[model samples]
Target chain A: MKTFPILLKTELKLSLRGMDMLIFALCMPVVMVLILGAVFGDRPAYDGASHTFLAQSFGAVSAIAICAGGVMGLPLVLSDYRGKKILKRFWVTPTSPAMLIAVQLTIYALYAFASLALVSLTATLLFGMRLAGSPIAFLGAYLLVMVSMFSIGALVGGLARDGKMAGALASILYFPMLVFSGATLPYEVMPPLMQRIADALPLTQGIKLLKAASLGLPAEGVALPIAVMAILALVCGGVALRFFRWE
Target chain B: MEYIVEAQGLRKTYGAVQALRGVSLRVQRGEVVGVLGANGAGKSTLIECILGVRKPDAGEIRLLGMHPERERKRLFAQVGVQFQQSAVQERIRVGELCQMTAALYPQTTPAAPLLAQFGLAGKLRQQVSDLSGGERQKLFIVLALLPMPQLVFLDELTTGLDARARRDVWQCLKQQKAQGLTIVLTSHFMDEVEALCDRVLILRHGQTHFEGTVQQAVAATPHQRLEDAYLWLTDDEREDNA
Candidate 1:
């Protein structure tokens, strides 16, 4: 644990040099909020909806970084390290591989939070957006979704056996969630059939939970999303732990 | 005799193939040991088992008077390793890699001087991937020694180096050996073995075929040079195994 801070600082530098997550995870969500505000400025989402289009999207758009970083960035790094035998090299040192992994997780979480703050600030300052939900509840919901997405990433990274397969799996999980999970596209606007399909994606459940929290909707409706996210976290995190390999 | 490494009756099988069978060797403190073998001769498997990266089916092994698996964290602190295929995280700056490595050991020598000794003096901010193969190879050796370890394991230490770079590395290693550092290295380069190793253990088909000093190996075979001696010794085993 004493080595963690240095590891984190170094890993953070590596991530910044790698740059994919910076563009997608740190900067993309803010860009998305600006796009949302510009495209549908101050206009109500639908005829009788209380929220404007940007306001309606505030919660889901905030999760773009999580879906990007947690689902794509985390596993890609894991598989790359595993494939290159970097993980094995690190293992040859006094540091445990778990320490390296924990540092990576912390880096992604830091990026996610930074993205969230930027997205929220953009929406509020540029387009007069405000969170209607309780601040504490909103934070809780955000973290739950982040965990769910990150666990799925871990499972793919642990089980894929190599970098190529992990990259393929990450793309398979990333694109559909980014496109159809109400993160990049609005959930309320999708056709019912499309909605049903999106609901099967974990991020869809996540966005649903986030949307409810952002809108200050009734808590009664969120039980299913909560259960889905929790179960996904437990199962995926457990399986990842069970099968994770250093070499 | 203060053996730094001791392995007895090591055996390992992979499915239908036996990679190591009853292989044993020992190294004393301050001695440089070389392991030489052809492509599929189980040198890697033996080394992996010795390093606790892979477990042997049957063996008792000790390094620095500690079990590799039982006291890994503590053992690793005093031992450095440079694997044949270990390319670290891409795009990581050399200085950062050194910093990250230096942080893991309880005691470490400064990396700048080590890097300088390997011709990478001012390349700290340079990314590792940007280095040439030989440069990367030298960087790894530099990293291995940064821990100021009592012993270091190097596989294919001079594979990518040019003649000058190889000589420079050999000279640097000679200096390390002079400073009471013990080394265990595997190399196909017999000249490297003859230059750096106080003793050589030749493995064939997962078993020790010869164990002796470089001069003894040449004396056993009717060859003038260590390389020719090595080739002549393993040639018969190749035919038998075939």
Candidate 2:
């Protein structure tokens, strides 16, 4: 465990040098929040909703960073390490592969929460957007969504034979979730068929849980979404663990 | 005999390909042992099994008097290895990689003096990707030696090096051997094995074809160079099998 801090420091330094994850996971979501807040500041979110558009979309928009980091950034880095034999190098040392994976997850989780905090601060200061739900419940939903998204990345990274394959798989999962999961485009504006399609996506269910927690709405009918996110997290994470190739 | 490594009846198969077949060898303390083999001759498989990186299909192996599979962590703390294809993160600086690796072992040689000894003092702040291939290989050797380990394993340690860089690495290995470090190395360069190894083991078709001192191996094919002797030994086995 003593090696954890050294490894984390090295990981953070390496992450800073790369900066691609920083731009995509940390900077992009803040930019989105600012743009969405400025352009549609006071528009009503839906026919019967009392919140403005930015307020309604806040939960989903916050998840954009998670998706970027978890689906795109995480897999690319892990697969690159495997391709370069970095994990195999560590396997011979006192530090094991399990420790490396744990450290990576911890680093991405830090990025996700940092992105969340930045988005929340920017939204509140720029547009007076505030969460209406229990802070504890909102945090719980945020963690669940983050874990579910990262699990998908782990599955791709753990199974991919190389970086190219991981990148291809990550993109296939990333773009669609960003556009159709009600994270970028509001779910209320989608056609009936699109809504049904979006409902089938893990991120869509994650956004629903997030929106309820953020709006302080009773999670009366959200049991299914919660269960879906939980199941996705478990199954994907389990598969990733079972099939992870250290070399 | 104070054997640093001992293996018996080591058999390993990857699907239908037999990577190792009943290979056994031993190395005493302070001995420099060179493992020589042609491509796919099970030198790597033998090393991996002994290092506890891979399990043999049927064998018993011990490192430093303890079973490697059962005492991997304990064994790794005392043994350092430089794999043929292993790499550090490209963006990491030289000093940082050294420091991180040093943190893994209970005892370590300080990074600064060691880097200077290897002619890498000025490259401490340089990223790994920025270094030349020889410099990177030297850095890997430095890492493998940093733990002050009782034994070290180096695979193709100077494969792509210029003569000067190769000599530099050879000098460092000689210094370590002089300090009573038991070294196990694999190299395609026959002269490297002759210059550095006290004893040489040649593997052919996943079996031990020859195991003896460099002089004994050379004398076996009298009036021939070590490289020719090596080829003659392996080629003789190939002919016998045919």
Candidate 3:
């Protein structure tokens, strides 16, 4: 427990002091939200509500940060540490590999929360959008999505050989989730076949589950998506931990 | 006196390459021993086996009278180590690194005194990346000595240092040895071994060909020099490779 906080502090300091990862974690998400919000402004989503696009899309934007940092950002960082022998150096110390992993998860969760807050603030103030569903539900959905995305990232980062490989793997997962998962393009607008493929993606289910929460809709239909997200979270998270390779 | 480090009939292989082949050696308490070897002579493998970093394929290893592989963590605390190229995060300050590493141990001396003693008192706040090679080496030595360990392993600790820095490190080692710490080190510098090692072991092809005082090792060679003796020990090794 103590090791987690210590390592988290060190990681956070490193993240802040370094420019590249900081831009990837903080700058890119804010830029994406602003650009997407501006370009998509005044355009109505599939629903006729003028402001529906902002509210729902804002949730997607938050999810983007979670996916980008947790899925892509974190694994590269962890793999880089391993490849550079930083993790190997720690192996000689009293610190266990498990503690190092815990620290990474903690820092990523913090980034997720920070991104969520920023996106929510931008949508509410700049776009004059209101969340349709219960705030508690929104919070719950956001946390679940963050955890699911982070687990996937951890699995990839742990299994990859180096930073380049981790970055490639993360990109393979991220772009599809961003584009085809109904985060950027609404699910109903996509072809039926594409919709089926999106349905198979964890991000698509995550977005649907989040949209249900933000729209105040009954979650009875969301059981399937939620179940899928939960299962992906478990299986990927377990495999990541079990087969995690540290240099 | 009981041997602080003992290995018997040790053997290790990585795929087709045999790193250690029935190699055996022993170091008694408070002895400053040096392992002189050419590239691929298995000095590092022998040290790693003793440190529990690598397990021997055959035979046994004992450090401080306990099995190293099974009791790694407990033995690690009792031993101090400086590897070939130790590196911490570039942005991490020396003081912070010292503090962090010190916290990992159950008992530790304060970093302030160690820094001052190593002539790094002014560079406590300086990031590790900014430090010169000698300063980094001194920092590592300070970290290794923080626990007042009974046995210290230094692998080519003076590799990149200038003559003055090398002498400083040797002096520090001598002082530390006077305080009753057993030192085991590997060095390519013949003068370093002659100046410091109470006994020198020449390793070639993962076996000890010569083990005695510096004078005896030098006297055994036709050329009567540490370098010549090292070459002589590995002459058969070169022929076998050819």
RMSD of each: 1.6, 1.6, 3.1
- Model 3 interface RMSD over true interface Cα atoms: 2.0
User: Each model's C-alpha lDDT?
Assistant: 0.90, 0.88, 0.79
Best by DockQ: 1
Give lDDT tens digits, candidate 2, residues B163-234: 988888899889888989999999999989988999999998899989999999989874467998888777
Q: How well does each candidate superpose onto the true structure, as a TM-score?
A: 0.97, 0.97, 0.88
lDDT of candidate 1 over B20-79, digit per residue (tens): 999998999999999999988999898899999999999999999999988999999999
DockQ of each model against the real complex?
0.75, 0.73, 0.42
Q: What is the DockQ of candidate 1?
A: 0.75
Candidate 2 DockQ category?
A: medium
Model 2 C-alpha lDDT per residue in residues A83-109, reported as the tens digit of each score = 988887776776687777888888889
A190: Cα error in model 2, Å: 2.2
Q: Look at candidate 3 and tell me the lDDT of residue B41.
A: 88
Model 1 chain A lowest lDDT segment of ten? A83-92
Decide which is better by TM-score, 1 or 3: 1
lDDT of 2: 0.88
Q: What is the TM-score of model 1 when looking only at chain B?
A: 0.96
State candidate 3's TM-score.
0.88
* TM-score, cand. 1: 0.97
| Fnat per predicted structure, each in turn | 0.76, 0.69, 0.19
